[model samples]
Target chain A: MESKPPDIQLRRLDDYRWEVPQTGKMRTRGLIYATWDMLPDIRTDQSIQQVANVATLPGIEGASLAMPDIHWGYGFPIGGVAAFNLTEGVISPGGVGYDINCGVRLLRSNLLRQEAEPILEDLVDALFRNIPSGLGSRRKDLKLTTPALRQVLRLGAAWAVKNGFGTADDLLHIEAGGQIPGADADLVSDKALDRGRDQLGTLGSGNHFVEVGYVQEIFDEAIARAFGLFPQQITVIIHTGSRGLGHQVCDDYIKIMMKAAAKYNIELPDRQLCCAPITSPEGEQYLAAMAAAANFAFTNRQLITHWVRESFEQVWPAGPRALGLELVYDVAHNIAKIETHTINQVTKKVCVHRKGATRAFAPHHPEVPEAYREVGQPVLIPGDMGRYSYVLVGTPQAMVETFGSTCHGAGRLLSRHQALKAAKGRSILQELAAKGIVVRGASRGTIAEEIPEAYKDVDNVVEVVQGAGISRKVAKLHPLGVIKG
Target chain B: MVNNSDPPKSKSGYRQLAHTADLGFRLYGESLADIFVNAAHALYGVMTDRRRIRGLECREVVVEAPDSGALLVEWLNQLLYLFDTTGFLGREVEVQEITSQRLQARLRGEPLDEERHQLNTGIKAATYHNLEVKETAAGWQATIILDI
Candidate 1:
């Protein structure tokens, strides 16, 4: 870990925003969106220093930005966002993290909380059984050949739909229509292909989960109505990402980028931040491979969504359509996209990197699906299983300031080891049970490592983004049951 | 023949470190080859109980890199790929040759049996964040972070 600078300087812009002045080799400043309550904890870590480090990258168009859920990660701090000029900027895999399109997908149902409460245990068990999860999780039934897997890499969620995992309409609600353009299966390595072959429809371990929840509170009735959400209505949230396939894609490219960085003579503050010019061959190949891995993630989630619906059907003895289990929206949290943003009143194309952040494009933005054009894109922020998760809408302010990005989730406050130590004697499952939450996990240690106390209060994190006017609250979902990998 | 059940009796081993969002392991060894072997052990230890894995199979892996850091990442990623694709676990790793630029190793283990092994965590890949292999008073030390 990088030693914390003794005197990390900061200028408070507001109660919800702080700035680290440009100094040394920094091309721009560092901006952190957080409240005073979150600053003390955020400052204790090295993430703020990462923000400063990012500001020094070549061709960084704006300040290195971090959402309220900032935490220390490998190169770019988790929740970090930075935009690079298309012509002059560089593309770093570290900025996108290991999980290429690690994201969240929310599903709304017509069933009421009261109606599902009695069968919550059975439902959770069915989900746990139906969804292959935990370490080394693979589906025995859905193994894909190299040829079929290539289609998955190229088509993403659309591939899953075509394979009878979901409806064609489901693709419309997904980011990038479930398949990012420019993905080339040829760019992916055989190692990645082998790793991803049997892993589709499986929920890999560590913080990835499927939670059964209900809309417990509504902040904006009109927007909530537009989002197809109502009080006490059941919902499901799937949190996962590209599995080993994406990891290998990133691992494969990081080596290539390291050489490319040296070849291009781009000075890197950290080796993990290795990058190449946007138009370089190395950069283009990495983007294509990353998109293919991202498509794998999209297809993985779509397959899981199908199984989730099946689990519900088995328990309730009713079809998914009868249960109204329709997809709300799917958004990628860890990704880099080519977008046009106005900088100093000049609209320019830039590669926006959102690591541990979500794109919150404003209403009427061409990227916003026509179905949600009036109320804006739905931003899903999943908190720890024990606390409430939130649904927020994108805002014009986000487009203006953040290059259309916002916080992803409640950031971690404790290390896994620390959480393990704190949970030594307590039965985390029992504790959750007392709160009327049904919880099932592949391992007890995983449950302990993910205790609610290990994460910052997501409510505070959400408040900062809303207070900053980058996102507006819509409804809050309370968990009833959860299945963790 | 190497007895896979017996753990490497090396003064230099590995220990888990603290990271807010991912897993970090600090490895130490008396020599560069020892460090490479121990790093493999550390990785397998993180995924499952290494003792239960038998040395019924052996596979040779050779990787060449421009530097030691990238070399280490490539080595670990090779092991990860084996596990991910074929459920091959390394009970023991014997470094036949080691240098800053290249390494040749014989990995001995068997396919993972769900009923026989208790799997712990799935590591995505080894990262280069603050990655360095250096000589210490104790010999050699390296710190690697794994994205989980």
Candidate 2:
């Protein structure tokens, strides 16, 4: 395919890492993690320039980083990761993108692929019917009162559990224990609350989905077992976010941050990079509001989990517990988290902005769930529905080199229009069916826009992270069914 | 006054631009008001086929921002907010007044009827990435990227 060469100078550091040397205004250099073969496509857009743009942010520590899935985004490139000094660094909503706390959760079940094969069609149909999906989809049966919605913003997944969505034990496997601290409901706008009132359990459109797959390969037996995976074991992956609420919060804050950037006199390489000092009132308010939205997302996924369980039960005639369907782990890919990391052999507090990236905290890190602390946090990398997904474990090297971060997924290789045009004369549903994958989508347009060819091969993306020692692959999963919004 | 019942041709005020994972467009007009109206037309065009929509309901909308660029984002975001909250999809937009910092529009459309309207895109918000709104030799033009 024809592509553009990187606009910025790239000095390769090794087989898996490239360096964008510090230039004019850059406070730190930029580091990109990708294989040599992927560099050409990575440079096809302005994402390389965006990585360098992030380096120009004030008080950025270490380097602006991009994972193998890096792609051009508004300000910070997708798959971008950066940490800033708490007192001097700035907070920008663009760093979190529009979907605050957009993440993925993996569910493991005792039923093997063979056991569910007979009912796969029915199960997928049930899930599609039970879960509200597609553009502007809402749960007519699940509207929340204003006061009730506030609790969701403050409590996240815990709120769902209390409301009888899931067990308290489920929270243990979630990031931040399913609730981010310092989230103030008052910080959220009425518009955001209104948008979120009825979207709690809806799978949103544009790349969001509920996929049923099975463990197809095991790279690490110990870690795979630790994560409750066995050969051909059935699993469900829920990919969604805080819905319209999160979008409004980011939109609302971006407007504020634009003014705040001028108020703080921060020189931005791009208008979308507008920000304010981390300690400034504007920055604090944004963090508080963003946290509230993040909580909403966590709760959103938890509610969906409940419906997913119900769907399985309807098809299998066995309850979730009987089927051994349990949450393996949940992690947010789009978020700005305040964390402590060692830089230059000195430990300091910095705000980590991970957009289209996942936290890969090493084994024994206090934040890893107690059950899996011996192995590490489970990092779920879901691929296109027609292909395969992978489960990986974080490594100590990630903490040292990349602030415990790894690639999120196979980044888009084709524009939506390109995918649509390529799918103009074909039915993607039937195409996937030929491969033994049952697919259901809210709209044919969505299915066309998301044809598997739209994305790069996830195996190649995962290979870079593993080769770089940031994460280690544990198991591979092949999709048998998928529900797209 | 334009008749609300008359079906307008799919105007050539805007054209789609390719974006890797999101949606984008470039719009043109002879005036800033035209730019704003054309931007809305383009916005709704991406969401659904405008030919299927009718000006059954008219909404008076106003927005204020720091500058023209911000005004464009706020204006389109207002339309998005309307669609998300009330399912109101505007097909015909008349810019009543527009300035560098504020805009007023009469948006004419109807509530989304899923059975009739073919939903094409779910736009999250208009973003500020390389956002532009300026006068050119041909006329006024604006570029925008919507986070989908």
Candidate 3:
């Protein structure tokens, strides 16, 4: 075990929370929502200081927040959250991450554990075949014309449905109804568009996965019914994002934003935090481009969803009716959305950037689907390959503390190289199979790097969020099979 | 000048050179006239065998970077981007000019004679993590990291 680093100043607020105070160069306090047990693990990361650095960003409204799953990433910590005042605040690409609108969506099926168990292998193989998973994997079927692709960027999931991927009703459960306003595909560069063109309907590698699982436990009976989840019922989770297209979009803009920051004279302590004012010409261009990439991701997932249903149809004949697959809710983990919040009891509109964070708007928010209006928004948290994933709901407390954000996953405890090194002697797939999980991937090294031992105990993370009441649990899921790139 | 190792001499006023993965080299000529001319060759060394890359004949290609870092990332990313987007791997490369502001660069390359990029795992773009290009005591030093 590596000894914890001594540099970060961690203070205990209670048994379940820790805080990195407003020390030097900090505009606001650095808040970490981890318990004492997680402290040693947290100490191993420089991301704690990154939280403090993010607090120093101009026009930052709330405290720079790190959830229990906090881990080091390129710019913002993987599980970091922050809300900036729209009028004076700034927007950074680091805050939204390179994968624009990378997110998780849950689909429920009527088949229970026993019914799905017999054909699980066939179903898993079907899913693996239908969706391309690997580095630079592209779909041969869905090539978009320039105008058609631009329209997809403008409409997002709505476009996916309009093009007959899924029904319009599926959009109701999606955050922002599947289309975030003001996404300008024209803002995306040709390189970004070119990279994105071939990647649609594919799952790009490195932490992107599609898991077949079942509801292991139900915490809220009523909410569970509303979410279409039940104990022992099988479910499928799709975890992916905007693919290379999103990455290229971010790359193209990081340069644009840097120059824009200089042109506007925006002082940046870290160039990774380099950004234009939210209302500036440079910032506007980025927002437009970012939204365009986000839309591409929505369409990508939408196309994948159609293939998933097709996969079930290949084996089960009547197209998932005999299997009973239905949509639950899809939520984005990396995105910046304009929202209204009550700051000092006055409603103010602000842009909330969630990087490796999930949005948790409370029940009855105009954006949530009508069916779930009373149960709140469904917050899907995918833990890791070996352990349990969760289905959560947005809460009133979430709006109060975190601008309605929650942890995204079981954060990494080791880098891919470190994990691969540790996994050198072990057969990760065999180990997972021993634990009753059937695993498949493009390469053995991919399995090694994504082994379950490389992460924190997600139960600890879920406890923190539940204790914080930012998001409440609905059901827990255990993975049966996983496919990765 | 003191007898210390320095960067290369350019037609304009930038240095285009090569280093290992630890510290990537970039040349910022600020004049669009010189951007890709320096970036192309700087990236070629990482993708192909430096010896082969050094031996290539001129095949003109124009490149651009939005700013200095973007130009730096784009210049490097374009080389990797070539390997992924196109199979035209390089054996030899030479960038004749570089510009930073409007981002322009030119380069020449021969077909694949090496596959050094296989050591990496599908690096999507060169990132700006701990990146720098400064006038050091030994002339100028540039650093970059490619995100795999």
Off by over 4 Å in 2: A1-6, B1-12
Off by over 4 Å in 1: B1-11
Residues A106-159, candidate 2, lDDT per residue (tens digit)? Answer: 999999999999999999999999998887788889999999999999999999
Clash pairs detected, candidate 2: none
Per-model interface RMSD values are 7.6, 8.5, 9.4
Candidate rank order under lDDT: 2, 1, 3
* TM-score (0 to 1) of chain B for each candidate: 0.90, 0.90, 0.53
Model 3 lDDT per residue over A1-485, tens place? 11233487777887666778888778888788888888777766567877888888778887898888887655677788988887888788888888899999888887788877777778778888889876556777887778888898899989989988988777876777778889998788877777777778898767788898999999999999999889999888888888777888887778777787788777766677777789888777888888888888888877888888888788667655676677798889998877888766878888788888999989987877899999899999998899999999999888888888999988877666567689998888888888878877755666776788777778889999999788999999999988887
What's the lDDT for residue A471 in model 1? 99
lDDT of 3: 0.74
Q: For candidate 2, lDDT tens digit of each residue in B5-111?
A: 32233333877778787877777777888888888988888788899998899998999998998899999899988888888999788887878999988988998
Instruction: Choose the strongest candidate by DockQ.
Output: 1
Q: Rank the candidates by TM-score, best first.
A: 2, 1, 3
Per-model DockQ: 0.41, 0.39, 0.13
lDDT of 1 by residue, A116-219 (tens): 99999999999999998887888999899999999999999999999899898889898889899899999999989999999999898888999999999999
Clashes of 3: 17
Error of 1 at B46 (Å): 1.8
